[model samples]
Target: MTNHAAGSIPDAANTLVSENGYYGAYGGSFIPEILVPAFAEISRHFEEIRHDGDFWQRYCALLANYSGRPTPLTYADRLTAHFDRAKIYIKREDLNHTGAHKLNNALGQALLAKRMGKTRIIAETGAGQHGVATATVAAKLGLSATIYMGREDMERQYANVFWMKRLGAEVVGVDYGSQTLKDAINETLRDWVSSFETTHYVLGTASGAHPFPAIVAFFQSIIGVETKDQILQAAGRLPDRVYACVGGGSNALGVFQAFFPHDEVGLVGVEAGGQGRDSSNHAARIAYGEGKPGVAQGYRTMFLQNSDGQMKDTYSIAAGLDYVGVSPILADLSEKGRVRFAAATDAEVVEALQLVMKTEGLIPALESTHAFAGAFQDIAESSKSDIFIINMSGRGDKDIFNIAEGLQDEEWKGFIKRKNSQFEDQSR
Candidate 1:
């Protein structure tokens, strides 16, 4: 462990094995025979190329020229003042070219695909940010892109559907169990099994079979590196806490990796409380589930599934946060109490969405609203007066359709009442 002026913990770079993976009993490749060779080839090349100076320089050039890297860190002055002079700053990943933090990892993976001479790219998405990012990069790199999206999500997030089409990606609608992220993933896994020789599966977040979670985390850690330097330069010190939302836990891991060295700096992860945990709807896997190791879409992690290997139905207004299984690294961290996991109800997320828009003039992705809900509440209760940094993971444009759909629903009142009761039950 390295010590800084701020309190310190283990360095992330040192936490990994020589093979580039982690999660003590949680993460590894559990794929079928056909895809195993492809994964092994990709993993071997990735370890070599990651250290190539020329490769990274080209990657940096693309990030600067195309995706606009070194995203700004903005101070939320109005909101900060409201919380008793505690400085609240946001890492503005929402302003990235594709309008979400997903672009950072997509660009990195796409570059790797180009080097591997892969001619086609396949990906799975929930709220569609990853699909849009993949589609954007595939169009730029002149590669064919296929995105598998759940049938339910395809209908709900139609604007993003149009965005993918405009980018020239073929969007395959998955109509399996529940027609959601898990089903979309199942479809993508099937595609990988059939076409691993000619295609690359660009996993969206930092959670998947062996090399993927580690590789994605390495790429996204740029967020934390830049944020650390930027915050120190701006505030003349490190933040007292950092907050981010977890889907498959990529963005959260990205931002958290930087501050992990600073043990005094709290790392908080927020999950979608959805309707509520008690309502059999929320996606707070760490907080409410019996959480056992299981494989879903090829990665072993804590799953909200049954003994017979059937997944439980999960609900969240933010589709990105509705995965039935979380990254094993996160599950391990939570189990060890190295990090704190909290849930934000849909009502709390809505309130947070409204708060940032009204005070900071920023409408964040609905998934990110969960982080704001937790951070704001933590600030309200903490006695320590220090700076806080939160990852503004994505912009809210895709959620306008969700908000509009909610407006037209006749069950809105009843839905809210049931959600409120669920929240009350969990809180009590």
Candidate 2:
């Protein structure tokens, strides 16, 4: 593949994977024969439309008018003062219409599905942000929508589940395997295998099969694109480092890809370190786990696997970060030392969340809090003149229940119980 430097627009032939979809031995299509046609169709249309100016015009217009574009790049003055090292800025993706960066990809893919004449949309979500985003777009477009979520995630993120249902989506809870994001992905793929004719599967992150990683990254690149421009305007130069939390790596790849060709800009991806890396509770596949390449979820990448090559279960206080495998593009980049990987434990993430709220007056999602924690660690030894930008991938509204529980907010729990009792009484 052709290599494009930073500050240039990346075309399919340059920035993305090869024609066969291998990103330096990491990414490829490894699906069954039955799914070949669907993947090929998506690949063909995406290749055609991605280069079309009209397609981008429409996509950008929708982003600006409907979903909110050019999200703010706010200077966290208090955070910088607290750190007393790096001057910190945050790309406020949390302020988007659906409260996260997921809507960017969701809206783009939904528009593509419309172009393809697909009438239904299916997606799998962990923290339910993607599901809510997908459902919101489907409702706006007057298309039928179905969301597959793990049973455990549905319970933990019940507020998002409620919003998705209210938006007119059929929510299916997968109970197989660990009954989490991985299982939800497996179920969504099975559904796509049979329904690929009239349905479009909106894969949540920058993982999965060939076109998906590329496609999702293409949509998400808007984040990095905006950040680069905004940071230049705000700080008069590129940041010394950019940090983002990586689950399936959509947000990280979104921000990192724009800075990939910039060797001076440090790219740091923070993974979920659960309880700790010493224990098996972390999802730091590229950081602490076996970095062996293997095929799972229709792509080859580094995964948390056991001796028998079975994918191991992962844990994180943030449901979105609890994944066994990461984005293949990120894996390849990490291996090549183009990007750095770090992990923040659950405790550190919670502390970071509180710190951001107290200092910046921004309630960041738990997933984004990992990036905050990682940035704190990295900036501690750096000079005060150093500049860092954190991609605040989502707001903390969806995570209020989880955060309250994590921080042991008994008053919040009592309020929730009171509300639940009121609803129960109304139902009775």
Candidate 3:
């Protein structure tokens, strides 16, 4: 709320968070009483630095000099021709440092941690992009860092795990309870409960408890701010619709935040459909009513759960989208109809990724392919004059293993085996 997302939001969100961080009945800090004071301290420090002009200047400087800012806005002519309807534009957040938009929030939180005099940092990652971002920042800041990732995601995104360790971070693989984003989150929170005095938990995405969602969104709003300016300059007007893949909803919220004030622009969030919707395995929390209103991971939101309140296992070809719940900010948006939600099944996402790589020569992360596949669902109904801006949240460099498997490339799998054998021989 904090005036950053002050305009055109719901009446409840128009003011600073009232009722102890509830965003219109969707958000609140539900945590151990032992960690209450720790969270309060984070809230206090965040409020102070957000208002400090000097802090803003320092953060912006780091973004420009170290992380790179003002990522490109490009027209996808080949994609437009193939679709033969709306003109396709891309907000190239994929080009940022660490090859993803996650760096924006990582740098912001790392600086805040420094200002608070915390030395050690902990994080949970699914796709591995956030883990890499956190490790990179920690190395540059000379702080200790530990990253918790799901065992399944570690295999799927092995490249990211390698980079995180090379950047001097301890990567812990969580093996129980679905072995994905949710389990990693649980582990990170458990670590934070005991180490809150010396460690800062850099909640990767725009979800979780009270101040975290707000804090992550504030850092990520740079995407929306830049896109608004770039689209106006390039297209001579605002886009008809903005599309972004929604996992934990950080990238989607980052791209949708500025456009909230401009009611003319439509906001679309596409969730991962691991299989067909009928299969009961996908992560389409919004489009499908599978995730009912509930609390998990320290906040209340719509989560995929059974009647007994036990969490349901969710699946996605993209490791990042394998979470059980959507962000509280997004949950509120869905109820109010401010954002339209959709799901792109695993098959559809793979097809979309292949098509874009062929047509536009961009290898977008599997997580982002959900948005492209979702938008393509509208091509037959739209006019050619309409403009659509899709946020490519990250590149596919760190997703080589997942992408190869998604395409069912047997040769690449064989190559991986051969390479592993060669490395084993050398190490021996």
Judged by TM-score, which candidate is best?
2
For residues 258-293, write the lDDT of model 1, one tens digit per residue. Answer: 887688888889988888777788888886655567
lDDT of 3 by residue, 274-336 (tens): 887899889988888788999888999999898999999989999999999988898988888
Please report, as a residue range, the 10-residue window in candidate 1 with the lowest summed lDDT. 1-10
lDDT digits (tens) for residues 120-233 of candidate 2: 999999999999999999998888999999998998899999999999999999997878999999999999999999999999998999989988998888888888888888
If the candidates were sorted by their TM-score against the true structure, best first, what order would they fall in? 2, 3, 1
Candidate 2: list runs displaced more than 4 Å. 1-16, 420-428
| Highest lDDT scorer | 2
Evaluate model 3: give its TM-score: 0.95
| True-structure lDDT of candidate 3 | 0.88
Pick the winner on TM-score between candidates 2 and 3: 2
| Residue pairs clashing, model 3 | none
Q: How many steric clashes does model 1 contain?
A: 1
